[model samples]
Target: MVGTYDLHYYQIDQIKRVRIVRRSDGCYVQFCIQADRNVDIQPAGKTIELDVGLSAFYTDSNGLKVDNPRHLRKSEKALKRLQKRVSRKKKGSNNRKRAVKKLGRKHLKVSRQRKDHAVKQALCVVKSNDFVAFEKLQIRNMVKNRRLAKSISDAGWSQFTQWLEYFGKVYGRIVVSVPPQYTSQNCSECGEVVKKSLSMRTHICKCGCVLDRDHNAAINILDKALKQAGYQLSTVGHTETHNAWEPLRW
Candidate 1:
């Protein structure tokens, strides 16, 4: 795979494997169904063992692209069923323990599925290109955004970055984290900061450039990082910082 080292476009695929051999009706066990390199076994005791696996993904034109329609649907249904069961369980009863176990198993399944999705997307991007760029959003703060909380978490951009970094080390691919600064606001054409509401999907700049908000942001972040040596982005308008990091943290 030395040629992968010199390739300008690569389609890297990242996948996460989870060990979830549990059941709901007590008749079936469901291990992670996503693509996996394989399974690793490490002994702990006479009978106990551990399974370890890493998540993977790639990038794309719009951004990181990972999709698994069937797997996602299955995970969603299991989660909904588990949620209802947990919600009905009594506070400190044995039923609660059962419910919690079921819920935990469900979460493990979903987490693996999600991580797989992210890795697949990130890998695609990385393998498709020599240089991969993604927005460095403050994941903690973004999760608090009431409107986008679910979708943002579902997207798992932060996890995607972690996977990208892992492959970057192993593959020697250049994975870059660009600033989550005024990527959308700042005009890519003339650098004018066009203020837009959260609802604004199109970045309409006075410089006559109209681009998808996220794409605009992505391109700007990429260019800015390319321009700056130290490569720090001004998160002046994107974050919710309370300290003295003006023009750097919102």
Candidate 2:
């Protein structure tokens, strides 16, 4: 079959398998390649941690915050319109099929937007820091809460982490996931566990430490990751010894 193809990236290795799948927008060809992909990245000489949330896509230990794109939320109106159109049409008729297809395409667009955002953010984080740490969240369990499920899913935490690990492997950077417990509750400066509700956005401790909740959490995550890896804060960002890029499996 003759078809036009666009290469998103250069294929550097032998093709292991090929699969074709149909989607609402169009058909796509997927290629599975076997290659040890590695890029030489100079040591960034910095260590950073990330805190993911619904309000913000992520807040880094350096006080940088990336706004959440909220792809699904942004497209909800269009999706609802399309869904209504689909329902109004006669069932199993050509018009109904057309309406359903349009709805499917809109959903596909939102999904793609979410994925693109995640990939760019993850890659940027991995490339800018020599050592990267993020909280290991149980997304499956978190989504069980009906109130926050939509927001949590929209945040795409799982996708972001997957790409973070993938880029870390490809770029020879260190990526570690630390436990989520007390990351937000503990004060970064004093290590005091001050209890606070989810609505409380500021972290305050008697040790004279005050910080944004997410910012404090990011710092704690970095500390936990460093301790888990048996490395001191001063030792990070030095030299890449013994292939530290391999992710520490917890």
Candidate 3:
């Protein structure tokens, strides 16, 4: 309480809890604010589905690609160098402590970057589209693949999805998570289930439809989400929104 404080406008009654902590770099405080959750925000009149992947952060239904900023991979060399230096230093030495702090700071920077990226991207997506659909990915199980564990973790899908849900709540947008079952295998054009391997980057169907694999998947995801949400869509080319949501039994 001795130093000047930068604070947001908050009512005394609205403040639920506050906690302060000291860090290697600085001291910070966290506040849990109480407020009404009933918020009404108008839809943006547009809908989009997102396909998240290691190759890119996301590919939207419109074929827009958001590049994945591999914060850890980008700074891996520097982090490794600092970690190696730290390991070589004598244990319990001041130099070793400093080196360790440096490494920790580097990691903190990456964490901040990933969170920042997720927040901004999620906000933009929520604000731009009224209805947003994404695959219901099981990150815990997905990370079990040792071959893709690093890339998947680095992509920060969980963080991104959390931000998406948060923003969706704030903006009153419809954010739905559709099952990831065959969204990629089924053709977005003719509804044909063309089997393909993970290595195939392009989706080709016998119905003369050839599209980017992610883009095709995004379309399918959107369709499924709309159906699950009670909207009957014609196709990817011509999408129509319905007011009623009736569960269709296949």
Clashes of each: 25, 0, 1
Query: Model 2, 15-134: lDDT tens per residue?
Result: 778899999988888877676889987877666789997679999887889999888998999999999999899988999999999999999889889999999999998898888889
lDDT of each: 0.54, 0.84, 0.82
lDDT of 3 by residue, 1-250 (tens): 4434434556877888988976667787877778656456554557789999767899998898999889989999999999999999999999999999999889889888988898899989988877789998888998998988888888888899988998888777778898899999999988999998878989999999999999999999988987785555673332334223312211
Scanning candidate 3 in windows of ten residues, the lowest lDDT window is 241-250
User: Order the candidates by lDDT, highest first — what do you get?
Assistant: 2, 3, 1
What tens digits encode model 1's per-residue C-alpha lDDT throughout 138-205?
87887797866656666666787788767655444455676666766788667899998877867898
In candidate 2, where is summed lDDT lowest over 10 consecutive residues?
241-250
Q: Model 1 — which ten-residue stretch has the worst lDDT?
A: 45-54
User: Each model's RMSD to truth, in Å?
Assistant: 15.4, 4.2, 3.8
| lDDT comparison, 2 vs 3, better candidate | 2
TM-score, cand. 3 vs. native? 0.88
